[model samples]
Target: MPWCSTARLLHLRSGAAQLDRLEKGTTGLGTADALLALDCSAERHHVGTFQVPGDVNDLDFPLPGVRLESTNVIEGDGANGVACITRITTGPGVTDYVTHEQECTYSTFGIHVGQGDRLAFFGEGQNISVHLSDCRNDVGRPGAEITIGLAVSPYRVLTIPKGVAHTLDGLGGVVTRDEPVW
Candidate 1:
């Protein structure tokens, strides 16, 4: 059974705002080693790392609407299946958003980008940005405030660990899905 089940829409104004919240430590996003043990499969997706060009001030901040789809698994074989699914949709002119998983549960974030839209990941501390494609490609400089471009795909899922504050930039008309595992 799922330990937590909740969902809500996050209307994010800018990446700067999200970064500020993370720096202030008010967002309540974090990571843990115990949670890392739950998802060993994530290691294969860990991939390589790269540095983000320019600074956070160089990008255009767009307003993005993020639909949080957190659902409880009513029935499943183990941790690999789900019997029920939930979805939420938003209107145009809504883009760019940020979110974090709760302390104990790990979340798999999937992003599907629309035309003229791009996505990047910003993690607190030493956490690196990841991109999922045919091969693993990790972007962003460790401990630096930078935005790295993430390719859009249904198969691209970033496993977010506990205690790690993270947010995405340039999610215009993008579909963001969050599946939390405990």
Candidate 2:
């Protein structure tokens, strides 16, 4: 069964306005919970799933031969704070793979990547809710949307394909590191 069946049923019975309020967190529901309460089961055509690897080498990359350094934390002896690092190594003929990081203070919506595929890895203790829509058709044309709730841990990766629109909720203080594959 889809994760948001009850939420979908509520949307069908209530209306989009209620869902909108839920999305905006005006309905007293937590932002992440509200996003997960949305109905997107019917529109998950291109939304990918989390790749939880038993070992770093077992990861399935969206693009072949793409290599990335696992998330590593370096502890300081006494005076310095810990540092986290994630590095991307491009393969042959692959010139550039830039990793970007964003720390969300609140729910952010309508994020779209038009150039290339994006691999997003969240920091420790991140509990995020994502709403993804595949907008591969002509501009302004609607496509399938999928809502995913994730408790992000180390070594987990989520792929967002180019031309897909996505939203992140309940990300206060959560840092999201994205590696773009071109």
Candidate 3:
């Protein structure tokens, strides 16, 4: 018989949110627990089960003053597929966090865990990965008002931070290094 799992979510005013897919099945046979949290150091409260293949960026989460931190895929069905986390600037240009297919397996990743306006999800399949997207609302604040687009692509969009360059390390993950220009 298929089993269900608990879920939790935490949203930070700084543009960060934590999501827990506690226990998910390969074919989405089990249930999930979703929670919304405020502030990176605050407690996580139960929200509800997420609709797989649903638009997560449209969710009306409370407390819009907190910054997001990371997307933690704690535990779930172990499968090999691709997941993308993209960071779109409010004006122009875009960044690709993780676009490699078959890379977002049961493993964990935090692509551009930072602040933005939207976050889209494009799982190789309709299965939800146990992960979190970190974010921070430190970009345009105080006196100056600016907004950025964090589109999680109903398909997948991962972004590398601006001004910082990355190189693929040994584990197929990007390694950050200081560079004078992109």
Candidate 4:
């Protein structure tokens, strides 16, 4: 559930809880009243967005991981919950395959950032198989920060970029299985 928006929305509708990411937006920063959508087809590397549906705008419910930039769309609220669109790096590891934990991996896909900021690289670069962490506060401040906690299955990946400051929980281990073909 870390960066999988489509999956979570389905869970929300089926279950009986809700979550949200942002209360409003900055420079088109947050949520809107459109269908839950995540698209990456333009020139931007990590650009992603969630659109509120056209029928359920007036629905009053909090959706976590959503940062409203312009104004909430006037319609569309088929469901209620928080949604995150993440772009995690997936590549060969040093020895075996590893899963990217959702707790520490902040997947920001197609979102632009300045060079001054550093990316939080998770997964293993060499063979050690590590839960990567870098001390770089890229999350601007106050209203600019977007943080959300989710329950998700494990995944394997390399660099992970968080929009703000985050702490990494490391799980050091050895990889005996060279590289996975899948």
Candidate 5:
């Protein structure tokens, strides 16, 4: 029988959001069990997914091979600092560790992760959830080079629009990074 695994989507409102083809392989790290994903929308600025093609050699993470940090970390209402919040890290790209908020473009954006350095897969063909275009280099295609996955936060789908230059701000939903996630 084909081991069918479903991904609990980060974008779903209700019901079981399962990645039909995704199965658990191995978990590299799991502390608080946060959400993570890779953005695959060619247009970018919008959340999407892209599979790791057999022909593809490089990873499409953000520019300079970013190191994602916890920006909009919110402590649970009842839980204080003691409450373990969101903890994120790249499983497959350990060696490709880039600084937090590193600047990168498609041609300029790429990260390196050893065979085991990347994020953990629940099983072969397992799909993880990502925020989708968590950071956009520009409104145009310059940002399209960046391919993303739910680097963390596997359960909750969050869309944070932290505008450019780290100075522009918007309303609603509590944006903390100033980096728009499309």
Candidate 6:
């Protein structure tokens, strides 16, 4: 199952998954103790310190026609570590393909896709290698987290597609809905 909300802001702690968009006046949401919001909308994707939870991996994406803007991972008190993202794609008359593994560390790394790109995180792991590729014109199950800024004209409804989910392994925290940024 998947969690869906249209509230301005949404926070998920204790390993929760979500999908929705932030209202015009919202600054987005936050997660502690390792939280992940798939296809979650807000100003950006923010992560905090905590151990990786065992149940925070492998989530399916629920929507299509959504593009991921970027992702960032900040380091905690722990020594240098690594995280990996495997992208799998499928569609009508479309063949399933794998994206070169995407990896990032607490060293502040991220990925950027153009407008209308469909992709998902297949898996996340520690000490993973770095690979980069694009999804061209396909979609797949959700597998990762962070913030996403949509690429469309103004006056358009901001919608987060399904088929994606976010998860933090550890470091549980609180999630707030419709919270002010300033």
Expressed as tens digits, the lDDT of each residue in 9-100 for candidate 1 is 11123245644654565555432222221222211222334343332223221112111112222455758633332222232434344444
Point out where model 3 deviates above 4 Å.
Answer: 1-40, 52-58, 62-89, 100-114, 130-182
Q: State the lDDT at 180 in candidate 3.
A: 15
Candidate 5 per-residue lDDT over residues 3-64, each given as its tens digit: 11111212222223222211232334221121222222233343334444333333434433
- Per-residue alpha-carbon lDDT of model 2 for 29-117, expressed as tens digits? 45564464353333334435443334442344332222233444444574753444444536222323232245443333343222343
| Best of the candidates, TM-score | 2
Candidate 3: Cα lDDT at 105: 38
- Which one wins by lDDT: 1 or 6? 1
Model 1, residue 135: what's the lDDT? Answer: 10
lDDT rank order? 2, 1, 3, 5, 6, 4
Each candidate's TM vs. the true structure?
A: 0.26, 0.43, 0.28, 0.17, 0.20, 0.17
Write the residue-wise lDDT of candidate 4 on 1-182 in tens digits.
01212222122221222223322233232333211222111111112222233222222112222221121213325374322224221433223334544343323222212111222222333222122112122222221222222112112222223221222233233221222211
Total clashes, candidate 6? 26
Candidate 2's C-alpha lDDT?
A: 0.46
Name model 4 segments beyond 4 Å from true.
Answer: 1-143, 155-159, 162-164, 168-182
> Roughly what TM-score does model 1 have, to 2 decimal places?
0.26
Find the candidate with the highest lDDT and give its number: 2
Native-to-model Cα distance after best TM-score fit, residue 162 in candidate 1, in Å: 0.7
Off by over 4 Å in 2: 1-86, 89-108, 111-113, 117-124, 138-142
lDDT of 1 at 126: 25
Clashes of each: 9, 0, 51, 49, 49, 26
Candidate 6 weakest lDDT stretch, 10 residues:
173-182
